[model samples]
Target: MNPTIELLNSHRSIRKYKSQPLPPGALESFIKAGQAASSSNHVQACSVIRVQDPSKRAQLAHLAGDQAYIEQAAEFLVFCADMKRNTEAAASTGIEPTLGMTEQLIVATVDVALFAQNVAIAAESEALGIVYIGGIRNNPSAISELLNLPEQVYPVFGMCIGYPDHQPEVKPRLPLEAVLMQDSYQEHEQAEQVAYYDQQMSEYYQARTGGNKTSNWSQSMAPMFGGKLRPHMRDFLIAQGFTMK
Candidate 1:
């Protein structure tokens, strides 16, 4: 297998982090790696806010669903899906802030996530650990205020980075047959595939959490499908200068 593929297979979220600070130049190199990601027409519609102040980090942690790891990590980075620069560029010439269509939101998000993942992978190559904190959107309004984000810019997510305090087994993903689609899409075998994946995941969870089982896909998929997350997201986006029409 390829080296990148081997590294990808070992990917896992690290929640607990050691107190050690990153070595000199580590953060800079990570930023450089992020910039190397391909952008949409080189727009590079992403910006990172690195939080090192303990009090600020704590406030961000509270905003991110009270995840203590956000404050505990050696570094906290908030990646933003930004069109603020474009808004400026338009004013500089004769263009206008494009009221991004709902579908185009995916482009902004994918651009940001790709850069974030590049940084994560680069850091991991040097033995650093990271956890993507999607919960940052739990209180996006408050987070935006705290981060002093402008209109046309929104926090895509946060990341906690540092030396890992512990090593855990890789979480089980669905079998190749389940997700690796062929020429023609088929759903007939999904039931059996899910059952097998569920068992593998259940065992993996039990072992990771000291024999206490949390949930299986069937049990949690319902609430997730019901949109239990920030349901006012459309309204929120409008407030942030994104027209989802």
Candidate 2:
């Protein structure tokens, strides 16, 4: 197997870490790699906050569902979808940006993910391991305040980077057929595809928990979508100045 392919394929969340620190200049290289990601119209609506203070890291970990890993990371970064820089630029010159001005929220989200993934790949290439912290969204306001984020900017996610303490199994993903569609959208096969995916996900989750847990994809998605998370997200986005019409 190709070494590059192997690195991409073997990706998994690494929570635990060693005390070993990253080499000097490694982080700059990683940030450069992340900035190299493709952006729509070159907006590059991404910004990152590197958490260096121990107290701040601990507080962030507490805010982010008490995920201990966030504090343990040698480098913890909070990625944000930011339009402030662009807006500031436009306002300073007395001009407004073109269409989708309100949609910078979405663009920034993609930018954050692109940069985060790029950093992950670079970190892996350097024998380091990392974990993305989606739990940071659990309390958006708290995160924004903790990082002192300005308006028109929102925390998309957090990431933990450090030397690995353990190697976990790579999580399985949905089959390609479930995600890929034909030339024209076919509604008929969707249910079957979802059902197959549900079964695969159920088995995958169960295996991860040593057969102590069982949950189908449909069952798992409800809490994540229909539950409090969705309404809270809508509220959070609105408060963050993203008026989703």
lDDT of 1 by residue, 1-245 (tens): 89988998898899999999999999989999999998877778899999998888989888888899999898999999987786687678976656667655766788899999999999999898999999888888988998899988999899999999989888878889988888977699899999988888777777878988777766657777876667867777889988877
Point to the candidate with the largest lDDT: 1
| Candidate 1 deviant stretches above 4 angstroms | none
lDDT of 2 by residue, 128-150 (tens): 99998888888888889989987
Q: What is the C-alpha lDDT of each candidate?
A: 0.87, 0.85
The TM-score that candidate 1 achieves is 0.94
Lowest summed lDDT window (length 10), candidate 2? 96-105
Q: Which stretches of candidate 2 lie over 4 Å from their true place?
A: 96-100
